[model samples]
Target: MGSVDKNPVPYCIVALMVVMMALSYGIQSADAQVITYRIHSDIFTELQDRYPEHAEDYWSSVKKAIRDGINAWIEVNPDLVVTPSHDERHNLLIEWIDSERVWGVEYHDRSLGYRIGIDFDSPEPDEYGASLLNPDIIKYVVAHEMGHVLGMGHSSDENHLMHGVENPKPKNIFDSKGYVVPHLSITDYRNIGGTQLDVSFHLQGYNVHDVAVVDINGTQYLVASTGNEGLHVLDMSNPDQPGLMDMDDSPSTDVWPLEGQPHIVQMYSDGFRVWSLSDPANIILLETVSHNSILDATLIYVDDTPLLVMVSKGLIQQYDLSDPHDARKSGAHHDNFNLLGVEDIHGVVRDSGSTYVLVDATFDGIQPYLIQPDKNPARVWHSFDQVEYYDHIQRIIEIDGSTYRITSTHDQIELYSVKPKIEPSDEDPETELIGHLLGYTVLGVDILEVGDSVYAVVATGPDGILGIHVGDKGAGKWTVG
Candidate 1:
């Protein structure tokens, strides 16, 4: 007995319209989609236990509650349509249970739902019933499950309905007190409208762990390796779902897309592979240069003069990719020279028009490596130890003239501000640590930034993928879904 509420407040309507306009104008690739859900009752005892005489009335009320929650979320995000399904065209399935045997099950169709199985015939009061029967809990469950149907995974943030557990602390949705929580927070609305403008994506598999983005011209590509599947390329003419372009059997760890050229230079475990994508479907392989001890190539940068900087395991190698079709290794240098002591490098970004490189270091420690590419040592970068120890550095972006780095460690996300340092004597300056932003314990992150805001696609354990908004320069944070 699932129902849906059609009418919503005017403020919610305005917010949804704004969100849709932003998505349509900002992100030109994919269309904003919606989802519908349906709840079914399995056994008669299940309803009878809860409402002895007025089972039908109670069922309708429960359905209405679920509908209200769904409508609330939709009012905030018009792009996310939540409606009730009368037939089989539903995105999610809900079932009321009467026993523990059917506690959790993953259906074959990849469609997931929740089961409220209870022992109605038992003489004793059901402990699980007490928690599940709560109106707020019931509504929360509907919202949480609908989150999955809407493509939101799970999240470690306790405040999120997608947080796996049936009931999370701070009982109320709005605040610590038991108040009626709105579907989307202010920060959430802003993020959905902001981050979609930037076209950036992260790729991970095998030893290939890295992030990359297609620049303004739709021709240039930039990538940074995080010690796994170096930097790889995908054809993005179809921006909604880009496909891998470089099919080289060798493991390419990092890549940097060259401006004014139809080719992207990538670093593989064995060497460097330059690819020409004028014909994106069938990529033309240009050249491959071999390296002796280069275990992984983390990042690559090419200047106006066409000098290439490739950051690899314990070293940063520079190359000459000016010839697009014919790339050659020119220079190579090691950072923290000793291979045994060097930490894994995650992100590397060269400040626009500057010779220095902003490197995000993780696993070894949360420190900023400011590298002066002109110096002989190239290790002249200052190391800041302000950020706590984290295992992985996921993404880094330059927003509002400030550099922000995101790291994944132990089950949490840490954000840091990078400020450039200027010394009177030296031409190259050092980057100072400004502050830390919001943190959350989540499985993985797919983050992007557009204009002044940041959005993260977080992987919640059983909850699924959730889109979260971490405000400008750590100003504020909230869950959008």
Candidate 2:
């Protein structure tokens, strides 16, 4: 339903097709302009059929909570959200079904709308099944189930409401007593789930400037910027208490890694500083690109050719590092943005053969620019609408096929699964809302995958650095970790 003039539509704009079992498995792209849900008569009839002995007021309370849950999300997002007529079936449906196996099942119908089924037969015997009438917890349950409809996966962080399983242990935000109720975590706001654990470490008692994680041999090290104190390399084998490895003696503005190649790190300060990690314990500066005050940079590989793309104030420059030592300029684009004085830009990520260029807080919130290196190498797709309420964009990371937008507004990060745009085309690829997480004072982010797990390393401004495990959200395994 959403389209762009010169701007390309984002994958999350239109709802993708979902089967009834999509929730049990997974679904994508439910970001319709207006998503509505109605309490199906089947749910009322199910209550009327089996629980005829219960008071009518009890069922009414449960129904209200479900509606309240949907309304709560509407208030949080920028979209026009509403509930349809009492008798009308809408984009999303909430119903009660006879299923003793599970308490709730969230899925999408053939129309590509979502439906959440609250099992009337089972009230969660292990976790206060009878407390379904408690609207507060019920509201949380609705929100959790609704998150999947919005295209969110389970959160690895147990503190988030999207935790897949029940936690008997008491946590700061989760209430396992009775029905499991968890606080709704702040996310991207296109709307998505998945809890994130914030693991932090000190950078020589300094407020960390920026951080990058690189694996050398079998050891992983954190190359972090310490203001003017130069670079501090920390041993991240134990991510909790990172031990300092070495320092660059000269500080850098930011850091990035060359894709596929290990031990090779890029630091940007007055210009680009390349380093070699032949020794995991020590890092050596290899070459320097004299371009001054580079805002952001990303590394891309086409065939075996390595391309280093950097964005400055007014122009985006590309360099071909066919020879790592003898670097050469390959291509450059001066007129990338139509908006004037656009300077809050932060990050660039590449996924599925496409390079996504991102800009933050430019009238519209953070949006993705899908750039493909085709015959012309200039094929780019502009990202979709913005949440008018949020702040500027901070960082953006694209992994697997998912795009994460870290925004300045409320320190929120939004997750969206972008349809594979292997090549550039006028027909905009659709994206679905994966979920969101709120990180306070988030300055930078780096997402890395090693085997079955994924990790997100965030650079918080004053609070220091945070090491987060993004959880196995994509794996359909939703047990509370």
Candidate 3:
């Protein structure tokens, strides 16, 4: 037996065969790209030769570990199709190695593609008798190695599984939810909102800037844009257990998934892009519209016409998006109206089932507009509440037949009942604040409906993701999960 260090060491590699059960999971969809893995023969032979007494247990544990690792990735991205492969271009190769040091090694071989080598020899348990070969520990190691296969480099965070060190203690890896938090990221289950709902999950270490949800056919998905790292598409078909379905590793700041269509308009610093998600596993870039002043945008359907509404320096512009590959300017609303210094636009959302649009213009507050047939929109109202500097108006969703706007500013989120002044009125339509929650900076937000309850999932920069139950205690109220 050799002592293991915090880093991978050079060792002689001996391929050993192993008999294992490799479960294959498939995604039934059109022209979907699938990631395949092959189990090398070295595993069973190495385990049987090294520890014949526990060879069966070792083989079973190793098999389960691989399955568990793949499953974890599927949970985060549901669009992934990882199945057993017996071909030339296997994405991953799993094998057993008789190594003196290191529990596992993930290396790329020209002929083998990506390969993972697990140690066949188990190290002596610590004083507490916690062996390195424990089933849960092995699963965690395999999951960490899988992260490398998925193109994630070693994380500097010591609490992360990709930190390059394998701590054999189970207590440090698993949380009360029975979830392998270390393998994913440190997730805080404590209540962070007023609703008392548990924070479902967190993609720690990633600076998530914005999120949007869309329904494809009968399935629902959420798109999370993390700026330069790219965008993540998560399947929300099972609201309680959202699975990551796909990811586009392109720089993105905001994403708006088109309604009743498998397309999304993603906005970056200087421009925006259109993507087709017909094949969630293989997201295709359809078009890019570059504008130096373009800050943020959203897709809205006026009557039956699909329009791309964008905000810039001091103007709100509309483009015809009937043809997703090409965008042509149709209408423009200059800032000469009621808008005040509209320099920074964080987000835009159309009031549900209405012709009104709400813009989250930081410092300027919420700006409401009425869509017209001639392409030019009319500014209905502009008001600022001097409580704090507003960042973004997350969404304007309909709950219990009432339209409510969710807005975030600094370190707090507020829900307000929005009534657009469609008809000429003496008193402005009720834009009254219902309830608010004070917390960390909430950069982006989206909603999920489970049965009769509505959950608001938010991206809190470094705080990761948190879930809130809308109207949990009663109507017009929120509770943190």
lDDT of 3 at 58: 68
Worst lDDT run of 10 residues, candidate 1, spans: 16-25
Q: Is candidate 2 or candidate 3 better by TM-score?
A: 3
Steric collisions counted per model: 30, 17, 25
Clash total of candidate 1: 30
Poorest lDDT segment (10 consecutive residues) of candidate 2: 11-20
Model-by-model lDDT, in order? 0.44, 0.53, 0.60
Please rank every candidate by lDDT, starting with the best: 3, 2, 1
Worst 10 residues of 3 by lDDT: 9-18
Off by over 4 Å in 1: 1-250, 292-296, 300-316, 325-330, 334-339, 346-375, 381-481
Task: Compose the digit string of candidate 1's lDDT tens values, residues 57-142.
Answer: 65665667567656766665545555677776664555543234543333424342322222223311122222222333345454
The TM-score values for the models, in the order shown, are: 0.38, 0.45, 0.47
Question: Against the hidden true structure, what lDDT does model 2 obtain?
Answer: 0.53
Task: Give the backbone clash total of model 3.
Answer: 25
